[model samples]
Every structure is written in C-alpha cells, then in structure tokens.
Target: MRRTELFFPRYAWRQPGATRGDERFRRASSLLCSLLLLLLSACSSISPKETAVSKTGESTFKSEPPKKVQAFATPERLKALDTQEAFEYRLGPGDMIGILVWRRPELSQEGILVSPDGFLTVPRIGNIQVLGLSVAEVKALVTSKLEFFYIEPEVTIRVQEFHNNKAFVLGRVSKPGVINFPGKGTLLEALALAGGIPDQNKDTSLTKCAIIRGNDTIIWIDLEDLLRNGNMALNAPVRNNDVIYIPESSDEMVYVLGEVQTPGAIQIRSGMTVLKAVMLAGGLNKNANAEKVFVVRQQTLKGDVIRVDLKKLLESGDFTQNFSLMANDIVYVSPGGMTKFNYAIEKIMPSLQMLNLGFSDLESLGVMERLRSKIWGQSGFINSSSSGATSTTTTTSP
Candidate 1:
C-alpha cells in the first residue's frame, strides 16, 4: 500500500480512477480536521492568565470588606453599669439628720438640722463638724465622742431630708427647674427628674446638652446618642449645683402652609424637595390649586417668592418644576384664582409671626391653638373680619 493509502485507508484510488469510498473517506477526514482546528482556536481565544486576572479583578471590585463598628452598651447594660459606681451621701448644711444610740434613749436626738456652719448640736457631744463627711464617717465620729462617757457605744446616723445638694435642668425640657437628690446622680437621672425633653421640642440636640459644674469645669452629655444608639460612654455623672442644659435644635426647617391639611413646620432633611415638603404637611387640601404653588424663601427680611407648577410636576413628571427647598423656606399651595405673590405672603405671615414669639408668650396667649384654628377656618387664611386681628397680622408684615 502507498503512503496515502496507509494514512487515509480507502482514499488512495487517484492512481487510475478513484472509487466512491475513496471520495467519502477524503470528505470525512477533511470534516474531522476542520472541527479539530475550530476547537483549538476557541481554546486559545482566552489564556489561563487572562481568565485568572479577570476573575480576580471582578471579585476585588464587586466585594468590599465589612467595616469595623465599635460595640456599645445596651440600655439595660448601661443602667447596670451606673449601679456599679459606689455613691455615698455626704452631710452638708441644711440637711436634717437623726442620731440614734442603741440602749441610750436620752443620748439619741431626732430632727437635728445641720447648721450653716456644718455643725450639729448634741446633748452631751458638743457641736461636731459633719460637713462634707459621709453618713458612715459621721457615725464613727459620734461614736468616738461618746466613748469618753460610755463603753462600746453603738451610734447610727440617718439623713431625714436632703436640701443642700441640687442639680438644675434647663432649656427644652418639660420641667426646667432644680432637682434635689440625696446622693450622687447621673445625667440621665437628672434629665428624668426634669421630665425629659418635651414632645414638641424633640428636636433638641442631646449631643449639645451641657453639664456645667463649678466655674471652670463643663461636661457635655450625649443623651441622644445614649438613648438612640446605646452609646453610654458619654453618660457622665452629674455633680451638685451642676446645670444640665438641653439646647433646642438649630436644624433648618421648612414650613408648608395654605391649602394643606396640616400646615406646619417640617425638618429639612437631605434631598428634601417642594413635593416632599407638601406631602409632609399632610398633602394638598381639596381646594388646593396644584398649578398655583409658591415657594417663599425668608433668608432675609424682605424674602423672595417663586411660583411652581405642581400639577405639571406630578402629572407630567416634570421634575425640573419640583424645586429643592432650603431651610426656612415656605411652600404655600394656594386656592384657585389666588395666584398673587402677595396673597401667598399674607397667608404665611401669621405663622412666621408666631414663630418669632417666645414660648412663654405663646403659652400665655394660647396662640398655638388659635393660630391653627384661624388658618384652618372658612376664610382659609388670616381673618380679616376683626380690626385687632388685622392689625396684629399686619405688624409682622413681610
């Protein structure tokens, strides 16, 4: 057999006349070679190194290592931690104390008030200086004094009323006054005694709340962090005469007025827009003319007003008309045919005036409730019927 016959068994018939089997064998061999070449080309398209690098780069970009967050104490655990601090009640001036001696009725005294000089008068024991001394230390001192008259005298000291040590809580709290405690108290306890921050004033910054002690020392308590996030590290212990001030929040706020269900102030958060502010004010009322919305910015005394087409914004998906609102901005949705800029200002002037009044004045005049009712009345704006009401509203003219 020739070389071609050995390689392609039946395809060696080209010497004289090729048989049908010779052509079929040649076609099958060509087909098999084409398939092998295609397989080789496909395998060489991507190298092993390229595949490895692609996978490595994808994993590196797609996945990130988790961040490390510090552990914080839970509320229950923080309370338990406060209990671990050993606190002893110290005797001071104006503290009513009682001295009891076992089996010595004549020597015992009740209702003994400590004088301003921090001295307590006893029947046999002369004035003893008990100032700044704990109850246990005072008991030891009294026992030592009685040792001269009797053998092994057992003395017990009790504090009937604590009046010398006090902590003051002021600003934004429900009750801003002095709080008297017998022993050492924590900042949390002082706030609780002062009735905590009022619901209306929930925007008070706990991080800014200060604990002022003496003339030089001031400690800041992060009550908000502690209460919200269980961060007890800043929960400092309050001292006598310490002033805990919970300052009102200085965060920017936007007001939504006019034809809204609940026209009031809403905090300015990130990405807040006119539409969001209107929704926060309980959405537009039934008579609200969505096409005639106005945004009044009171950055200065004169203020600037911009007209917004809220109907187009919501129905036509025109986001460009839904402007971003700034702090102290007023979003007023007016009634139909009341599109004048001055009319919108007239609607919002009363609210702006009320904001300027102090909390005390507003409380005394019952202005908050009256203002709400007046805004929601049939007129749907400031009442023009009464001359006094008109004069008062005009005084706060923009």
Candidate 2:
C-alpha cells in the first residue's frame, strides 16, 4: 500500500528563460498538487513503532521499549472485602418487592415497585426508604413498623422482580442492556452478560472502558489490562446502578494543529499515520516547515515529544518519518524556521483552546472518593480485608 504524497516545494524549480505563462503553469501545478492531498490514503498500526528524530534532523528507530502509560491516572483499582463481609444485592429504584404479614392478608402488599427517589409506598405505612437495603434488612424494618399498629406482627418480604439489582452495560458492545445479578455481580460477569466487547475490523475498536457510579465519577479501565495483561485488579465489582460504558475508538481523536489549511481535529481512522493526518487536515501551506514536524503525545507526566522530518519522507519516500498516531496525539506542522518545541506549543495553544478536549490535565479520577469506596462498600460492607486473607473474588474500583 503506497501513500500518494504530492509535495509542492515553496520555491518552484524553473528554467532561466521562463515566460509569464510558464509561471502561471507552475502556480496551476501547485494548486493541483494541493487538491490531490485531500484524497488521502492512510495505512498504519494502533501501537506504532517508536521512530525518534534527532536534533541534527535524522530519523532513528530506538531499540528501547515504549514507555508504559497508565490508562487511568489513578494508581490502583478497588479491592473487595472479606467473605465475612461479602457483597449482598441491595435494593435500588425500580426494584419490586412483595410484603406479607402473618394472618393479615389485607395488610400485605404484593409487587410494590420502588420509586425513582428510592422510596416504597406501603398500604398501612405511607413511604419507606427501601433503597440500598437487602431483603433481610427490609424484613427487619417492616416488622418494626408493623409492631406499632398490630399485635406481635410478623413480616416476610422477598424481592419480587429484582429490577434494580442490575448493572447497565452501554456503548459499543455486542449486547448492551441491564444485566441482572441474582447474587453478586463482577465487572467480568456484567461484560459477559452484555455479550462481551466486539471487534470493528481495523476501523474502530473497543479498547477502553469506564465505570461511572454515583456523583458521575469515572474510573478508566483498560481492556488490555483485563484480557492481555492479566491484570485481575481491573475486574472491579459491579454495583447496582453502576454504568459501564465502553466507548468507541473514535473517542480517542487525533488533533491536527499547525500550518495546515484546515487545522483542527481529525477523527482517528484505521491506519492513521502522521502524513495521512496532515493530508486529511487539508495538507500543509507554503509556510509549513516540512523539515521539522512534531508529534506531541500525552503518554506520561512529562509527555512524549517526537520530532519527524517530513520533508525527507515526502521527497525520498521514507516511511520511517511517517510513524503511526495513537489516541490524543497532536501533530504540529510548524512554519519554516520555527523548529523549537516550546515555540510550536505556543502557536498550537490558542487553537487547542477553541476545541472541547483540553490537553491541560489528564482525565483525573478523584482520590478521596477512592478512599471512601475502599472503606464503605455498596451495601455498607467494610471492605477492609483483601483476597489474601479472605475468600473474596470481586475486585472493585474506588
């Protein structure tokens, strides 16, 4: 697969005895070349090989491995508590319950659905907070309330529908819907119930996932960590009302900002390379410094800044200079003479400000909430002892 590159040099090469019509023809040729770049043909991989450009303007393939980046900035995923404090399915909104009083069929209620506000309206009792309480807990609460009105009242409550004891698996998955957990649900179990993640050819893939709980807290979970890396730590417990969204590959956009005609964002397509990204952004103008193109990526804290001499690639057909682009990658084609990194960043900042996605900070998952999730569990279980001490299986995210 050949990438059709049409390089129109800033200085037109002409003969000594050139006519006025000859200059017009050269201008016409430049216009035609620029138009051809719009029909770009891209070919690259997701994890591109590291090709570093030296300060002396030479492309060198590094032997060292690529830096390991944490998918989510937070260090650890949530851990489960001991079996003694095992996770019990708690009631939530939309859950249906059946209440029966001993020798009092008239006072009993059947299939009473919990309201969105987490309250259940009973026959005798007006409203009760049934949300986040187990079936055994509900029985105890009902018995106390009935004791005030009736003599030695015995109450038996069972989950009729178990509607709210589920996790929502949304986004680009095979079967996305509410997954019911009869006992306890784990991240892996929910994913399996939702028909697992799908492969969308070479275009877009289900690479990453997130667990959104109360207060819109998002904990980034790497799919690789679960499937390939064997990081069982990522298999967090699925709490009721928890939303697991596995976003498409398009969420990871490639920002093409620089001396290009249409400098903004290009949807990261399959085989998206540096040259293809530049071409898709309406190609470069005459002021574009083809000698020093930069791909500024936010992999780690300091950031991974790689320099690419694109002029050599275009003229000599060198694929080394045209490395692949990953998610959240910034391809900056500087104007002639401005090769310094800081200078290019200064020029690119203003353009980035207009865009919705900011490069200012990494997607930060709060710490205090993590500490809170570590201590207090969904159904008020103390998540103190880990798997080492207890027979705990469900790993959770804080």
TM-scores for all predictions? 0.43, 0.48
* Tens-place lDDT digits, model 2, residues 70-133: 3662334365321325777778888888888889998888889999989988778779998888
lDDT of 1 at 367: 36
RMSD of candidate 2 to true structure, Å: 32.5
Which ten residues in a row are the worst by lDDT in model 1? 389-398
Prediction-by-prediction clash tally: 0, 3
Name the Cα RMSD for model 1: 32.3
Q: In model 1, what are the clashing residue pairs, if there are any?
A: none
User: Candidate 1, residue 220: CA error in Å?
Assistant: 1.5
Cα-lDDT of candidate 2? 0.71
After superposition, candidate 1 runs with Cα above 4 Å error: 1-85, 182-184, 202-207, 250-398
Error of model 1, residue 28, in angstroms = 99
